[model samples]
Target: MLVGPRPLTFVAVALAAAIVVNSEAASAQPDAGTSQAAKDAARELATKGIELYHKGRFAEALEQIQQAEERYAAPTHRVYIARCLVGLGRLVEAKAMYERLGSEPRPREMAPAVRDAYGAAATELTALEARIPKVAIAIVGASTGAELSIDGNPRPLPAGPIDVDPGSHVVVVTNGERRAERRFSAVEGAKVEVRLELAEAVQEEEQGSLVPAIVLFSVGGAATVVGAVTGGLSLAKVSELEERCVDGHCPASDQDEADFAEALGTTSTVTFAVAGAAVVTGIVLAVVRPGGSSANTGAAATSAKSIVIDPVVAPGFIGVRGRF
Candidate 1:
């Protein structure tokens, strides 16, 4: 949300001249090692910085002012740098410069020009503090295990109404395997609120359903049970035939029973084979949970609208039949 255009606060000619004169590079240094050449160079840099700043070439002015500060530190240099940063939309760094200037100790013998710069620093610090933007972030998930990050800088849980520079930023919230991301821009003097939610239902919905796999496994289990029952019955019939028959052949009455048992034995073998195939197929489906695959969806669509999975038995036939 763009609040409005941020205009640069123009520096009046009188104020800029006052800063260059009072910079005090040559006469005010406590160090005797400060040579006349270094002081001259510092003064020259500060003068050029003021000229560039007046023309709105803030980046070039900031470079000049920073070089001057490196050569010989002064309150005036910091004030100019802070102003340049403001012109560049870097409120946070600008606020820091003003803060540091305000915190430096003042000497009783300090020059009136230097004191004037100090007073200006204090006044600007107050305004800069108000102009620095704030961003509040909250995660609506587990109280523990969740982590929050702002522009790749990891922040602690319950991360806050944090101070930020006025610009675009990214907020990331993570809890275990779940993650959420948001992008927003912060405006000067404005507060932005962000919320992230990670829910179990959302995760479950994304990974597909387990219902189809469960159904396959249940049908496979029923087929296995039917095969086992038939196998046991066929074994019982063999034992009865062995007892009733002697030598290499069965009695006349036992012959028909023997033929029936032979058919039952064949039926048992086929039923067991079918059971094995079904159970194997069920294992495949359970391993690869269905509902998300195109092939699985197509199979489900083409399967019989009404179907049953059970052992089919009659006077002459015994087997298992069903569709999944």
Candidate 2:
């Protein structure tokens, strides 16, 4: 027997339809260019979302309700969104939503249904205040470039208390190359404080360049070769003087050559001592002066602790000395 539409079927069909006549529909007037068809579609989606929420399917309900608000742009939908966020264990976002709703004016011209939704958001926020977690962060010795971040995303430092979800969170403070990080758990409705400490700044001297060492080594090597050649000539001259003057006594004729040879020997000895000291100083510098090469650019540049190495060259002294 063919029967008229069954009671359950009629109820389902009614639930599927949009409620255009409700007072909630009057809350925010349609935008300037909104078409009648668009309004009807948005209303239908909101209706479906409400039904899903009653059935305890909060995630699906949140998506539908969010779309409806985006389509219609109503403040009343905030209440529904916040409710769904609470159901999803996202207490922080839900608290922000409720706080935003509370700060907005309850439009005196609002329809009764919209006013009721606003009132409901206010009442809900009161209870949520006790269940939400509060977090405060303070930076000690923070530099001018210091910045705060939460979960890897940059955020402004809170002047007062900030709402956060219960559980573990990463808080970071960064100032140039210096960074401070903290990871900890927060309990619901409890206050957590974090102090970020900065490390002390160090003063370092500028590094010595390798060019000076290389130059010194080259010059010293040349000087040493010149000194050796002069020394050999001076020795040969002395041998001739020794043959001419017998028993360490130089005759008048050999006296002039003897004085010249003595003078040459002194010059050679002084030059050799200076050259040896220079070469030793250059070698020590090349060994310890770090990566001052022009080839090392960008990150390849090395910073090394430096000490002043001096070439000590005197009439009788030739060595390398260092003062840290």
Candidate 3:
């Protein structure tokens, strides 16, 4: 006889449930052999690292622990690795590892060790950072061929990484008719990068106004012309006195002529002095005027370009020396 359909359906449902249960059981079984093998390898590496540490081979110990740490995923293994790094004076790497492991909640029994390791690593890191040298400076602006200055003294441009005493300093930058200034600090050997934008206008002003030179020349030239005229009038008076003295006259008239001659002589001496002063003034004006002479023009241009005034230091504190 043929089996009934209801019986067939029930048998199918029982088979499906059995298959599902078997699959769950298989998945739940731990691969004890694989896990044990991994643990054994990690332990072996850690033991080798410890032996190296005992032998005073700190570098090798660090290498072995690092390898085991990479291979093992356990928090306990990682702590050991951090400790080895600390022993090797690799404080930065040790600090990183300890910080990572310390963030996780450890078992109550292991919490104290973890906290201690973390604290020690942090302390070591702090000490290392303090011992290292560091420098911090703001480069406000620079021209293509600009030079740097420290505390108003000319320093080489594009300064090589500088090691400086730990403190703040005044820094200045200079280019043709452009300048910039800022404060900076350095500590031992650390490099501090600071970027400051220099206002183009302010730099131009720091180079100083060109108007002063022009004013000086103008005033000097005017004074020179006035002196020349006064000198000529005095010279003419002396010549007239001599002519009168040469003409025949009575003793009284002659005496008056003699007096006039003395006065004229005095006037001539004054004229000569005035004339010398005028000539000197004119020469100075000519030399100082823009584009007047090759030497003077070059000097004036250089002065204008590299000028910087330190108003805070003193009234006469002028930092004029610079490299081209």
Candidate No. with top TM-score: 2
| RMSD (Å) of each candidate, 1 decimal | 12.1, 9.9, 22.4
Off by over 4 Å in 2: 1-19, 22-25, 28-33, 47-63, 106-116, 142-159, 172-180, 203-205, 216-279, 287-318, 322-324
Q: Residues 162-237, candidate 1: write the lDDT tens digits.
A: 8788889998888877788899899989999987777643322223355665775676677677767777887899
Ranking by TM-score: 2, 1, 3
Give every collision pair in model 3.
Answer: 133-188, 133-189, 133-190, 134-187, 134-189, 134-190, 135-190
TM-score (all chains, Cα) for each model: 0.53, 0.57, 0.30
lDDT for each candidate structure: 0.67, 0.71, 0.49
Which parts of model 3 have CA positions greater than 4 angstroms off?
1-34, 83-89, 108-139, 142-324
Q: Extract clashing residue pairs from model 1.
A: none
lDDT of 1 at 108: 57
- Assess candidate 2 and give its lDDT: 0.71
Candidate 2: C-alpha RMSD to true structure equals 9.9
**What is the Å distance of residue 125 in model 2 from its true position?**
1.7
Pick out the ten consecutive residues of candidate 3 with the lowest summed lDDT.
Answer: 310-319
